[model samples]
Target: MPLRLPPLPALRFFEAAGRHQSFKLAAAELNVTPSAISHGIVGLEQALGVELFAREPRGISLTASGADYLSYVSEAFSLIAIGTQRLPNHRADRPIALSCAPTFASRWLLPRLAGFRARWPNVNVSVDTSHRQVGFPVDGFDFAVRMSRAPVAGTAWTRLFGERFVPVCSPAYLANLRDEQGNADLRRATLIHVNAASEDWQAWFDATGTEGIDTAAGLRVDTIQLAFEAAAMGLGVALGRRPLVDRDIDNGTLVQACAATIASTTAYWLVSAENADRRPELFDFKRWLVSEAEHFDTHANPADQALQSTAN
Candidate 1:
């Protein structure tokens, strides 16, 4: 049979008091009165028939037995804290869940997620990468990052990155491309198509203001990263967001086809409940994202803090 133990409340109070060497500080952390903490510790000492603390003029100090007991208590409390931290990650409410388009999630968000974690270590990020529209109130998600041309009604939205489309292809594809007009020479190349986003091609066609080109006839993909990968593999041309494709463009893996890139009305937007507008975690994420976006616009590598300095 296992040995029965004293009440948990008494043991907890004693442990906190011993660790802090102050009932007042322990009461603050436990959200209890100082007197109550003192009483619980006194009750514990009475039960054990040992002097745990050496009462002093400035503050309390641990007795020989108390010092030994504190080592065990500290380890136990550390284990409890570790377990408690995991509970929030599993909890359904306020889950810090985010919804994003498949292409953006795979190509843009996932690649940069480590930076987000580095900034906010406590936040538990759950990503829902889908092309489908997510209604947050009906879906019970804490937040959603949507890529759209227009903001949805009845939702709080913050524009994450302005839309700027550039035609990008792998270095081999660019080398093989026969264009006397440099960047504007993409009219001869085969255009990659995103099946879900017919508008991207339509916008390109609109910007070119040319006719007799079929935008529908190419290797069709559903995700942005897939299209990008196809382009990177020297298969064909793909229109890419500046924020998502900037790194590839800079590193010589991809090259811009022209300076005719247009800033589209479409943009990456963060959507959430109005009540969560000022949430600290959400706010921190938003600020970081905006900072990165701005940095990328002015400079190439936003992650390299030194890049901006060299450019200036």
Candidate 2:
């Protein structure tokens, strides 16, 4: 006699939906349409002869049976993942997937990745720079870097670094400032703002004690990287974050428009599942990230202190 199983596809969809507590989110994780998720769940309910979800106007919720089913399904998947990871070739060839913010991916991590690659030549790394918050193992990401004011629950997370905002512009743009008076009359200059970091300019202004400038008047860009690029092209002065714009400043493409800087409440966090660091490659990457962040902090502290003093 052979053991029977429910439809695997339907089971998978059910698992995702159950775990996320939302069909739409499950669809996103599985890279399918919400209708597909709904159909799969419907088929699953029919196959099992049980009502798994309680449908509501806004969304769906798992019933008692669905909640119970989810635990077993999740454990089975975890076991399979662990089994595959134990394979020798799987360990060697599997790429570590990391999710990050687009601006941080381009402005900060991408520039520093060469060092990681040089040190670990055999370890493959894949980075996803979508704005969507990653769902960890379900989303197939080994880890993620997120900018957040507070730590996300259920995941092991480390603070990479806090952010500080300072006004930056192309040297040409600064030079073209009327009467070479630095940032004193910034109201007359074009301002570049990143929609994602909307509060930065106002924060900088408050810290510097500069008044009467309209913080909202600017060329709004979607990402800090785009704002930096615009400022580099002499489009406008942009409020740049420390560490992210350090390379541009080093290369002389961007210069401080003023001495004032504002510390941001938000910080970059490296987040992963509790067991993710058990893998040697992932552990190595985590260690390297911490070391890099430490190195940056050491160098940035002096300027940060000066900014703090001025703000005080």
- Using lDDT as the measure, which candidate wins? 2
lDDT of the structure predicted as candidate 1: 0.70
Superposed by TM-score, candidate 1 places the C-alpha of residue 103 at a distance from the truth, in angstroms, of 3.1
**TM-score, per-candidate, Cα-based:** 0.59, 0.75
By summed lDDT, the worst window of 10 consecutive residues in model 2 runs over 176-185
lDDT of 2 by residue, 1-312 (tens): 998999888988988888888888888877999999999999989988999999999888889988998888877776666666656667566788899888788877888899999999999899998666565465667889888888978788889898888888999888777465434358777999888763678777776688988887879888888989999999999888887888899899999887667788888899985557678898999999878988987888898888667746
lDDT string, candidate 1, 1-312, tens digits = 998776679878877777567888778757899999988888878887888888888989889998887777656655564354346454423546678777667767777779988877877778887444443343345567776787888678777766567688887787667556453456567899887763587786687575777876777888777888888898898987667777788788888755456566777777875445445776777677667656654663343234323323
State the displacement of the C-alpha of residue 245, model 1, in Å, after optimal TM-score superposition. 1.1
Candidate 2, 303: how far from true, in Å?
Answer: 3.4
TM-score of 1: 0.59
Each prediction's whole-model lDDT (CA): 0.70, 0.83
